[model samples]
Target: MKALTIEPLTRDAFAPFGDVIELQGARQIPINLGTTIRYHDLARIDVTDAGGRAIVNLFRGQPRVLPFEVTMLERHPLGSQAFIPLTDKPYLVVVAAAGELDPEAVRAFVTRGWQGVNYAKGVWHHPLIALDDVSDFIVVDRGGEGHNCDEQALPESLWLTSEGLRGAAG
Candidate 1:
């Protein structure tokens, strides 16, 4: 199997797929009598589809060993999903554009310990691949009627190893 190249997560690089939830260049709003600064509009949450409502969840993900095989991808056609890491550990994100899953169009990224991602509706992506330890994430997604998740098996599996990681920013 061929190894995938894992790029460092960046807003520009990840824009085609969805928003990157980070505080680097987010809009700042001073609230709480000027005692708190809010990072406003970090990501767009779109869960209102087919009677679907936005729901918040706490997800604890087990760590995944390196050289992980990516054989399939899933997507939510009805709503978007956002994952905010509660644990300060790097993780892997694999994604393909919304539409038919073309394995060749797949891209991989490695997040900094503080970075998070929001996969837009209909965007194809692999499940969370947490590293180092058991990580927790604040997941915001759709919850209601209608089938949302769709999984597709890749034509061939790709392996993600440590050596494949590119600029894993500290």
Candidate 2:
């Protein structure tokens, strides 16, 4: 199997695949008598298709060990999907661009607990890869949809290394 090194998640590096959800360098607006700071419009929630609506749900993700094997990737054709960790634990994100499923285009990102990601519509990505412990995430995605998901099995398996990924920023 081929090996892929996981990189740190950053906004600029992840732009082709999705939006990085973090407060760093984000627009802030104080609201409610200046008691709360609002990070407004951080991610583009593109569920504007007919009969498409946004829905919020809590996802309990099972943790996966290092040197994980990746055999498949999936995409949402109708709407976007966002995953925001609800706990202070690191997680893994694997993604490719929005076109052909080129194995060479695949990239991996390890995120801090406070970070979240919004996968753009038709963006190819692996499912949640929570680590450390059983984690819960606040997921935002489309509800009413025709078959919104498409899965593709890789012709060859890939391996992800957990080491050499810490503290390396994109």
Which candidate comes out best when scored by lDDT?
1
- Give the number of the best model, judged by TM-score: 1
Clashing pairs in 2: none
lDDT tens digits by residue: candidate 1, 21-140: 999999999999999999999999999999999999999989999879999999999999999998779999999999988899899999987889999999999999999899999999
lDDT tens per residue, model 2, 1-170? 68777888899989999899999999999999999999988899887676899999999999998779999999998889999988989888999999788988899998978899999999999999998799999999998958898999998998876554553445
Deviation in Å, model 1, residue 78 alpha carbon: 0.3
Error of 2 at 79 (Å): 0.6
Give per-residue lDDT, candidate 1, residue 165: 69
Give the TM-score (vs. native) of candidate 1. Answer: 0.97
